[model samples]
Target: MKNKILLVLIAIAAPVFFSGCATDAHYVQTGDKQQIISAGKINSQDFATAANDASRNLLSMDPNPLDKVDRSPAFVVFSKIVNNTDQSVDQDLLTQKIGIALTQSGKAQIKIVDKLGEDYGNIDDFLNDKKTTRRPDFTLSGKIIQTVDRAGRTRRGTYSFQMSLNDPKNRAQVWMFEKEIVKQGTRDAVGF
Candidate 1:
């Protein structure tokens, strides 16, 4: 009789155990209120904020490079973007957004560097002898840094995005911009 009661109890409990795991999946926009806030690592919102600030500051210089150009848009090549943060981050997340915004403004053009080619031109240029590629007027380079602080259950994180625009002709930084993003929360939470 005990064996029969155990089997009955097991049968009743099986569905209850499985029913607890019915979690629905949903999509959350970047920087949205529902987005999971992480105090330990950088978030998509941080990238966006950095991109916006860098683009604005770079474009609004006193002697606008793009406006100074009489002909086509001023060319810019992306230099090594150092990721000095604790978390692994795709550098494109920062550069691409700024590039798109700069491009959309019709002020600047970003040239993709080709490893095989000698200059910042298409890979096909490797076969051609003609140096048809226009040299970049400026080089853009930057670094991303992260800082963390913890006090008992409270935790804080700060991320800094720094960028410099260097003139290829003079090899001097014509413009520099930095944007800082900070997040704070409790350590009791996961990945705080």
Candidate 2:
């Protein structure tokens, strides 16, 4: 009887001991179908999709500000991207993609605000006395909101990405867009 009990204990312990050794790690492309779908966090593809949609629509407006002027590339300034979600996100994922698309489309140039000014901290970069003044035709601002719900074993997370473009000269909103991305998963007994 003691031998029988020891054999059963080993049977149980053997799997547990080796389970921790079977971790699989590999690299995957962004937006790949193999990427883990979590109900608790936002993914990279979410940002890309939102940016693509907003940029596409923004470029389609009739009599768009970008085309009205002789300036081949209209200038723009990126303002705040307010994060109302519980998850902290880097804004560049969205802004950089949109900025690149706009630049590549030959429609706009997003001017980055220079914080160091003409001087460079301990050292200095004020070598050039000449200054070039460029003004942005528009400003971009937006907010991201999250909503989560859990019922029994099922959990869901919804994210809303909102964006708007405003004409700085007239202080009027020129365009607005929002994209909603949802992720759902059922909690398993194994706690994945």
> Clashes per prediction?
0, 0
Worst lDDT 10-window in candidate 1: 120-129
Clashing pairs in 1: none
Q: What's the TM-score of each model vs. the native? A: 0.73, 0.72
Taking all chains together, the TM-score of candidate 1 against the true structure is 0.73
Error of 2 at 66 (Å): 2.3
Per-residue lDDT, model 2, residue 92, is 82
The TM-score of candidate 2 is 0.72
**Residue-wise C-alpha lDDT for candidate 1, range 58-138, written one tens digit per residue:** 778877866665556877777667888878888889889988988899988886442324363432332342465665666
What global local distance difference test value does model 1 have? 0.76
Q: Which residue runs does candidate 1 get wrong by more than 4 Å?
A: 1-23, 114-131, 187-192
Q: Best candidate per lDDT, number?
A: 1
C-alpha lDDT (0 to 100) for residue 138 of candidate 1: 68
Task: Determine the C-alpha RMSD for candidate 1 after optimal superposition of all C-alphas.
Answer: 7.4
Give the lowest summed-lDDT range of ten residues in model 2.
118-127
